[model samples]
Target: MSGVDAFPGKGKVAHCDKEKFDLKKELARVTRERDILKKALGYFAKQKE
Candidate 1:
């Protein structure tokens, strides 16, 4: 049993592998973006008051 097999019909083998290869980088980038977005939202909220 492998990661791809664990979930069926999600994608082709190459596509799945591509995502897995970049999963860590993608995760870090997304996490950073989320934090930046939260801070931006907080700033806007404060400014509205």
Candidate 2:
């Protein structure tokens, strides 16, 4: 009834599911990259100071 499922059509539902899955994967990748960057930044900051 709400959020990525407003459409009742079969194709739409499938697309929504795929999109949700893709988003989850992308989120995980981005989170990992962000964590790596934070660690690198901290390392550089420590080296600089």
Candidate 3:
């Protein structure tokens, strides 16, 4: 009763934690790609001048 038996919602908590981890990983990847696209856009914008 002192271990996992004390928390019946531990499974749900673990699932949420895993989902959060995956979201954060995807966010990082999207952010990196966005930055690259921004840089490319800037390069092309300068060509018009």
Please write out the lDDT profile of model 3 over residues 1-49, one tens digit for every residue.
Answer: 7886787763565877889999999999999999999999999999998
lDDT ranking from best candidate downward: 3, 1, 2
TM-score of each: 0.58, 0.71, 0.69
For candidate 3, the 10 contiguous residues with the lowest summed lDDT are 4-13
The positional error of residue 12 in candidate 2, measured at the CA in angstroms, is 12
The TM-score of predicted model 3 comes to 0.69
Top-TM-score structure, candidate number: 2
Q: Which stretches of candidate 1 lie over 4 Å from their true place?
A: 1-21
lDDT of 2 by residue, 2-26 (tens): 8678765655457778899999999
Q: What lDDT does the true structure give each of the candidates?
A: 0.89, 0.89, 0.90
lDDT of 2 at 18: 88
What's the residue-level lDDT of 19 in candidate 2? 95
**Which window of ten consecutive residues has the lowest lDDT sum in model 1?**
9-18
What is the C-alpha lDDT profile of model 1 across 1-49, one tens digit per residue?
9986887874567877788879978999999999999999999999999
TM-score result, candidate 1: 0.58
Top candidate, metric lDDT: 3
Candidate 1's error at 43, in angstroms?
Answer: 0.2
